[model samples]
Target: MRTPAARTRAGSAALAATAALLLGLAAAPAAVAGADHRQDATTLDGLAHRSGRYFGSAVDNPELADTDYANLLGSEFGQTTPGNGMKWYATEPRRGVFDFTAGDEIVNYARSKGLTVRGHTLLWHSQLPDWLSSGTWSADELRSILKNHITQVVKHYRGKVFAWDVANEIMNEDGTYRDNIFYKTIGPSYIADALRWARAADPKAKLYLNDYNVEGTGAKSDAYYALIQRLKADGVPVDGFGMQAHLALQYGFPYQMRQNIQRFADLGVDVAVTELDIRMILPADATRTAQQADWYGQVTSACLAVRRCVGITLWGYSDRHSWIPAAFEGQGAALPWDEELRRKPAYDAIGAALTAAAVRRTG
Candidate 1:
C-alpha cells in the first residue's frame, strides 16, 4: 500500500535498527574483551596479586651481575629468595664474627627491584662455616652458639625479610631426623630452640621449616606435618611450611600435590613452594618438554587452589644460572627459562595457570 519512496525509507529505518541491535550485542563482548585485555597486559606478579598471593624467584649474588637476568627478575617477580647469600657460610664466615655483605647485596638488589625477600635460611645442614661445622661443643655451648646465630641473623634482616626458613632439610626421607651436625651435637631440641630464638629476634617474621621431598604426602612430608602439629601444640612460633619441590622428570610428578598442599593449609600455617624446578636427563625431547610444561601448570594450579598456599618461588627463574647442571650430573634444563633467557613452555604454562586463577577470582 506504500509508495516507492516510502518503501525505501522504511527499509532504511529497519536496517538502522538492526545495525544498532547488532552493535549492542557486539558492545557486550567488547566490555569483556577489555577485561581480558587488561589481564593479558598484567605481569605474573599482577595476576598473583589478584588472588592475594605472590610469584617469586631465587637470585644469587653472582647471577645479578647478568644485567638481562637481573632486569627481568626485578620486573617480573614480586618476591625473591637469596639462593646462597643468606646461608650460614655466607652470612657468618667465622666464629662470633658475622659478615652480612653477601646477604646485604641481595637484600639491597631486591629493594631496588621492588621485590620483597624471603630470608633463605637461618640454619641448614650443609654450607655451614668451618667454625660451626668443624667444631665439637657440648650441648650447652652449641645451644648458646645456635641461639646467638639465629638471633643476630634474624634481627639484622628482620624488617627487610618477610619470612625466614628457620631450619632447612631437618628430616630424612624415612621420616626420621637427619643426623646432621646440629642433630648430632645439639640434639632434637635444637629445632624448637631455633624457632623460638628466631621468634624472639623478630616476632613479626614468619618462621618456616623447609625441606625437599615433601611435595607429596609421603613419609618425609608426614614427618613435617607431625612436627609442625606438635610445635603448634606447644605454642612454638611456627608460621609456615616450605616444600622445596625439586622435581625430576624421571621421578614422576609428585603424588597428589593438591591434596598435600591443602593438608598443610588445614594445619593453620601458610604453605609455600620454596624452590621449584623440574629437571630431565640431558638432551630434552618434545615429550619431556611437554610433560615438563604439564607439571609446571599442575604445580601452579595446586598452589592456587589452596587459600593458605601463599606463593611460589622458582629456585632460579632461568636455566642460564640453574644449580642443577652443576649439582645433578647428566640432568639439566630444570627452569622455566632456557639458558638464552628465552621462555620455555613451562613459562607459558605457569602464566596460563596464574591467569586462570585470576579469572576465577574476578568472575
Candidate 2:
C-alpha cells in the first residue's frame, strides 16, 4: 500500500517489452439446456448479490433488436454497459452540436428491463468525431472543448448511469502513458481535469478510469498502479479502476489477478472486471474450451476475493454477436453462450464461482 509509484517507475526501461508480447489476454462451444439440468433457483446475478457483487454484460443497440438475444441479456444479468452508444462520436458527431438519440434508447431499454446502465465513455482516443480529431486548435480551445464534452454528456445521463468509464484505454500496453490527442494537445493534466468535470456534472455517478491488460501484475499494470497513486495524491476524482480483462487463452490467464485487484483496492477505490471476455486461436477444441471455463471461474473468484471489487461485466454474453472474431482474426468463440443461445461450460463455471462466493459470505 505504500506508494508503488516510485518503486515501479524505476523499472520503466523494461516495461515496454512485456507489454508488446500480448496486447490482451482471453476462449468458448454449444448445446440445449433444460430446466432439470440447470440450477432452477440461482441466477448469476442472484448469487453475486448474496456476495454483494453484480454480474453484468455489455450491450449494443443492434443486439437488442433480436428478442432471444435481448431476453437472455435482461434475464441473466443485473447490469449493462452500452458498448458504443455513449461514445463521443455517437453522442456528439459535430462540434458545438450534440445528439443523444442512440444513447437515450439504450438507457431507456435498460430502465424498462430493470437493469442499471454504465456510461461507456466520456473521453477516449478512438471513436471520436472527425471534427474534434481533425481540427487543429490552440491549447486553451482544446482544453475548453474537452471539459465541455465531458460536462454535457455526463449531465445528459446524470442519474441514469451509475458509473462512467470517464476515460477508456488511455494507456498503451507498455507502462508509459499513451500519447493520445489529449496528451499532445493539452498534456497529461487533461485526465485529472476530465474526471473533475465529470464529477461536477454527476456527483452521484461513480467515476472510473478503465483500461485493458491491467488485470495482472506486469509492467503495464504497474504503470497504472503508479499513475493511480499519483492521481489520488493530487485529489483527483477517480473513484474506480476498471480492468477490461479481455483475456486470450493462448497468452495464459493473467498472473496473480486476485492480488492485482487487491493492490488497486488498497488505493482506496472500487475495482471491477469491466469488459471480461476470453478468446483463443481459431478451430476450437474440447481442451481449449475447458481451459476457458477455468479462466472464467478464476476471474470471478479473483473479484470475489477482494473487498472492493464491486462487479463483473462481459464485453458481450454470446459468441453470436461477439466483437472478437472481427477484432482478432482466427480468434472467436469468446462468451458463456454459443451462437444458438445455448449455455456452454463457461456458464456453469461462472455460476459455481458466484455460488461459492455467496457461500463464503455466509460462512
Cα lDDT tens digits, model 2, 1-363, are 111211112322222222212211111111122211122224566567888888889999999898788876777777899999999999889987989988998888778767788899999999999999999988899999998999999999998999999988888877777998998989888999999999999999999999998887888889888988999999999899999998888776775789999999999999999999999898889977777777787789899999899999999999999999999999988998899987766777777677667667899
Candidate 1 lDDT (Cα, 0 to 1): 0.83
Model 1: residue 174 alpha-carbon error in angstroms:
0.3
TM-score versus the correct structure, for each prediction: 0.89, 0.89
Q: How far is candidate 1 from the true structure (C-alpha RMSD, Å)?
A: 13.9
Note the clash tally of each candidate. 0, 8
| Candidate 2 stretches greater than 4 Å from native | 1-41
Model 2 reaches what TM-score against the true structure?
0.89
RMSD of each: 13.9, 9.1
